[model samples]
Target: MSGAPEDLAERPVHGVRGEPFRRLLTTWTATSVADGVRAAALPLYAAVSTRDPVSVSAVAAAEVVPWLLIALPAGALVDRMRCRGTLVAAHSFRAVVTLLLVWFVHSGQTGTFVLLGCAFLLSSAETFADSATQSLLVSAAGERELERANGRFVGAETIGVEIAGPLAAAGLFAWRPELCFAVTALAFGFAAVWILRVSPEVEPVRAAERRSMAGEIRQGAVFVLSSPGLRAVVGTVGLVALLTSAVNAIAVLFVLESLGLAPSTVPTLLVCTAAGTLVASRTTAGLSTRFGGAPVMTGALLVLAGGVAALELVRLPGAAWGAYFLMGFGAGTWNVLSSANRQRLTPGPMMGRVTSAYRVFAWGLMPLGAAAAGPLAEVTSPATVIVVAALSIAVVAGFCAPVLRRSLP
Candidate 1:
């Protein structure tokens, strides 16, 4: 107990300074190229190339489906492989795929189904790289530094996700969309070189004992389902993610029709949310240390609930500003608390599997949320749908309050 505080103080921040950190950043940037550009550009490109929402959504779903299907197995593979090799190979393959995509686009021969199929393949490789990258850091840095490592990783990845290729994609699409894919391909190649240079501190995976993949998958599923503490955390986060993804789908409708906001205001308003998330990621450590993850998470969810509820009352004048501000703050803090909670409870070796499992739930339901938003909005309007979402947040937060207040040793 006496040594605990000192141990915490010595934590190393991943992707923060040090020569090796550059490699991590470069590795991170690889994913960012595809990430920032994918949501808008991919779907929009699909529409222009072929007006098929079914095909476009399939592309989006294909990208996400791999994460749900392969992430756990990828995590297990990470535990058994050389991390650097996995990352290097993953990026190298990504580069190849992106280049092939670019060539197809340049030839004006890109098809809706072809793009969707390729998205699945690229997303599959990414699953392997992502798990290994996550597992390698804590394995190298020791358990104590997991928070700092993750914090930096989260912040850097967030920034890249927020910025990176979106700006370029927008520019290059106007000039030439094909060039944009080529640029993305180059980014992946740069990442591959960076990862190849760094050495990974590999960990042994003797527990597997060469077990069947299906058996191992069942073991992971059982572990996640059986833990009440973890379930609460994942369930709460999943709820938030699902709801927010839904909110995102209807945000333009809310801003334009309900709140009567102008087009120019959209960027400024969206930036506020991004700013809040960045601030939250930076400050998560302090909050988690003070209140512990569970309490902070509970409060974050409650705050998010209040924010959502406030959306119900957002009228003209100062009310609109305040409601949106609260929403940004709540959403931002939720990510901080959820990430901290996951890192705190999970052991280093199991971090990959647990994180994958957590994501399986948290991210898995996002499509459902997006799908639900349309019908709900059609039936009850965007504002009412969000209010219903707010109530769900409130109910879940109330249920978790007791667990949240209990301190971890």
Candidate 2:
């Protein structure tokens, strides 16, 4: 009880500063590169190997399964454990898994099943790393600067994971898929090293008494579901994730088959979208500061809807790139505003659980979205599926706006 006010008072009006914040940001950037590389390389590997939309979707779904299955328990564990240690351990685990994957690729033994399994294991590690990082940032940056901190974090991620990672991986993947995996392993390994060097003070200590994981997990779920604002945010993000994942599930196929782009050139085209994301991350804090988070969120969603719809209409490369750019920009802005709002609403002790619970709805539905994408593309056209997703996203945004406006911090 006594700590609540002290924690509240920790919020600062200015951007976060100091060595710890820098270290955490560095770690995020490094690991995002690893994620980016894997995201691009692995999908291409699947598409190259199987050439089946369903199989590619399977790989995508496998990556997100941990978010649905283990998120709640992982949240509970995060609340009771040291976040920094978790970060290091998770990255280390990913590094080892990636190395094994490289070996499989080298031996020419990699298949759809093995790729899917590896993706699931690597992303399971990500579940821990992501949850722990969110909790750690609250301590390092304080609640007030969460918007800025998350913006910077997102910006770095967009550049590394969305932009640089894809481009680098595309090049390496074109040469030898094994080289891409080696780079991913190296990135995760380095991220662990940076996180290890972060000072002790930056890591929050959650005093523990032996307690049932079920109870802790329940507490987190109740906190999120009991709050209308959190629920609204979760609902809105879930819808977007569903739609976005569906589009992305077939994105490579759309580019290679529909757009007539080569596999090696896919990442280059995506960089247009990544550029929008990078710009949005740099600008979202100021936009929210001026227009307010709720309105900003609403406006960004409108852009996303329009951009996505435009993609279906446009066949020219320039026009399609523009559409993807708009989607990325809107997505980037919405992410910053939503994340900062969640951080502000959640208490320190419950941060881990609340964040994970939020993701269960927000991200867990991605597999469903991915699964839907393949069949939908087979029946109709990929463009038709994207148009439907865009319209649905717009409706969800409109429906959630009033609740979000009333609830946002």
Q: In lDDT terms, which candidate is top?
A: 2
> lDDT value for candidate 1?
0.71
Residue 44 of model 2 has an lDDT of 88
lDDT of each: 0.71, 0.85
Model 2 CA deviation exceeding 4 Å by range? 1-15, 43-60, 103-117, 174-176, 199-210, 249-268, 313-317, 373-384
lDDT of 1 by residue, 102-209 (tens): 888889989987799778878888888877776666544445554555556666665566656676678888998887778777877888887775543556456646
Ten consecutive residues with minimal summed lDDT in candidate 2? 201-210
Question: How far in Å is the alpha carbon of 375 misplaced in model 1?
Answer: 2.4
Name the regions of candidate 1 deviating beyond 4 angstroms: 1-18, 197-200, 316-325, 407-409
TM-score of 1: 0.87
The residue pairs that clash in candidate 1, if any, are: none
**Candidate 2 residue-wise lDDT, 230-277, digit = tens:** 988988898898999998888778767777777877655578788888
